[model samples]
Target: MSDVDQSQLFEFLCRMGDNTLVLGHRVSEWCGHAPVLEEDIALANTALDLIGQTQMWLGLAGEVEDKSRSADDLAMLRDVWDFRNVLLVEQPNGDFGQTMMRQFLFDAWHLAMLKALTGSCDDRIAAIAAKSVKEVQYHVERSGDTVVGLGDGTSESHRRMQKALDLLWPYVGEMFVADAVDEAMAKAGVAPDPATLRDAFDARVEAVLTDATLTIPDGGFAHKGGKTGFQHSEHLGHLLTQMQWLQRAYPGATW
Candidate 1:
């Protein structure tokens, strides 16, 4: 790849990494607040896994970018528009059911994407994907099972789970839409074409929802502009403010 292409690739990877890091932080916020003890453990474990993956990806991105910035700097210093994560990850955790639904959607897509990424020509990304696939697989299973259980549990539970799924459906579109950056990476065999993963992701998620006795919500409105070049939701500003406050308030301060 040319230097320009490599630069784009680095930015892309950093975006991916930052997305995971931010979402992991959000999920970790639920550590002690989960509705049940077992779920608390499960969500916490997933949060750790995501954070670890973020570190690996961000490290690689930093190296590729050839900038002096540390992963922490890249993660904490980027503005909301500068962020490349899908909006789904930044969406508020509405309820226990909503949170699970969000995870279910993201994990299912990420698992397939990561599986394909394992074969990428970019050895660094491939290695990261190889390591992350195991954790992502478990995350999908746990979230999927919960989605099924709650969807079929009772009238109230079913209603909440379905509503959760519906509310999250719009954000799913951003995950599969490929852009120029992705196309360049795809040609260089550095990244998977997200469109290719859509079918498998849909099949897997649909099957899980079917078994859960849940309906696939109509994806009427598509939520775009979180990853590529679109504006983010208001929630992202608040998330970044909280995340960056300590670092900005006291530069170079450490525990």
Candidate 2:
């Protein structure tokens, strides 16, 4: 492979790894705090799945870059500016309704991306996607069900759900925004171009929202600046500090 292709592929892998790592951390925070025992376990399982996916994706990324970095190193040692996760995943879990809304939005796009990625020309990418798609399917079902419940249920739930959706809707656009990394990887058959997933993502999200009796915000302001590594949010740093402290202090310490 050419240097350009290698670079793009490496970057693309980091992007995938970072998305899961950050979101997994966010979800994992719900470990002892979920509203009910069942939800606590369910979200914890989702978080574990995401963190496992991150290890796989980032392990592949480490190989692609030919760097000595392991998946653990990539996840725990990287500084904030180097992370490529979209801003949506790093957004704080406002409340249970907000967290579910964020989960639903990301689940829709993530599942679509993985479905397309299952056909990736790169066998490793395809293999990972094939496995991950199954897990993400569950994420979609759980989150989507909750969204419908909250949006279509009582007055308080409906209002909170709507508030969460409005606050998060702008971040949704970042998922479908294509960059040079996407262009190169798509051309090399290593990954799908995210731009192509927009329509289908929109349709899936709309269907869920409609069933829940929620309205899509007319807001045209889409937040950006995460993929290229210049994140405008402070949450990532705070999260990384908590996530990386043990690894940083202990260096290679394992249970």
Candidate 3:
């Protein structure tokens, strides 16, 4: 691969790893605080799965860049602006319904992405996707069921779910907006084209929304950036401060 191609692939891998790591951290915050014990366990497991995937993806990213940095270095040392996670994952988790809505939306896209990637020409990516897709399947099932139940339940539950959906829909756009790196990766069969996943993602989302008795919002503005390692929601900096404090304060300290 050319230097430019390797650079783009590195950026693409960073984006994937960063998204999972940040979202896992966000979900991990729900530990011991979920509405019930079962949910607490469930969220923690999901968070663990995401973070585990981060190790593999970011480990490969470091190798691709020929950098001596480890995955721990990438995860713990990067500044907020250096993260390439989509805006959706970094959005503040609100009520229970909001968190599920966010998870459901992401799981839908994530599953599609991983499934496509299982066939990637890049063997490492294909291997990772094959393993991770099973975990994402469970994530989708859990979050999708929660979405439908809350959306179709009591009037208040229904209202809250709808509100969460509307609030989150705007950020969903960023997941599908392909840039140069995305185009390059797709050309190399190292990644799937985000555009190609749109139709299936829309259908899957619509099926859940229909069953949930929820209406898709009309004409909300879409948020972008985060893939560029430049723009982020204000929440990311705060999240990083909490997440990176120990590493920054005590670099190279080992258990």
Candidate 4:
């Protein structure tokens, strides 16, 4: 492979890993804080699943980069700017309703991406995608169910669900925008172009939102920069501070 292909593949792997890592941390914040015991346990389990996926993706990323860095080193030692998660996952979990809304949206997109990856020419990539897709299948089901419950249950719940949808809609666009890394991955048959996932994503979203009685906002204004590492929200820095503190403060400390 050419240097450019290798670099882009490493980047693609990091993008996959960082998405799960950041979002896993965000979901973990709901532990003990969820509305009820059942929800609390469910969210925690979901977080664990995502974190487990992160280890594999980032572990492969480390190898592909030919760097000595392990997954822990990449996840805990990197600054906010080094992260390549899409903007959607890193957005704060606003409230139970909002969090579920965010989860449903991302789960829909994530499942599509993973399914596409199952057909990847690269055996390793296909293997991860096959394994990860099973977990995300359940994730999308749970999150989509929650969204429908809230959106169609009561006037108050419906309002909050709609509001969350509007608030998060912009970030959704970034996931489908093909960039240079996407181009390389597509060329290498490592993965499909990001735009190709949009149709599946939109179909799932539309079906769920329709059942939920929610309205998607009208606009094409997408917030970029998160996955590209060109920029991130102020929240990412704050999140990194909390997430990396243990490693940063006690450098090389073991669990």
- Against the hidden reference, what TM-scores do the models get? 0.96, 0.96, 0.97, 0.98
Candidate 1: pairs in clash: none
Ranking by TM-score: 4, 3, 2, 1
lDDT of each: 0.87, 0.92, 0.92, 0.94
Model 2 alpha-carbon drift over 4 Å, by segment: 1-4
Pairs of residues clashing in candidate 3: none
lDDT (Cα, tens digit) per residue for candidate 1, span 1-255: 453387789868976797788789889889899998988998899999999999898888888878787778788777887888889999998899999999999999889989999998888889999999999999999999999999989999999998998888999988998988888888888888889999999899989999888898764577988887478889989888887898879877778
Cα miss at 253, model 3 (Å)? 1.8
For model 4, how does the per-residue alpha-carbon lDDT over 159-181 read when each residue is reduced to its tens digit?
A: 99999999999999999999989
Worst 10 residues of 4 by lDDT: 1-10
Could you report the Cα RMSD, in angstroms, for every candidate shown? 1.3, 1.3, 1.2, 1.1
Pitting candidate 2 against candidate 3, the one with the higher lDDT is 3
Residue 210, candidate 3: C-alpha displacement in angstroms: 0.9
Query: Best candidate, lDDT-wise?
Result: 4
Please report the candidate that would top TM-score against the real structure.
4
TM-score comparison, 3 vs 4, better candidate:
4
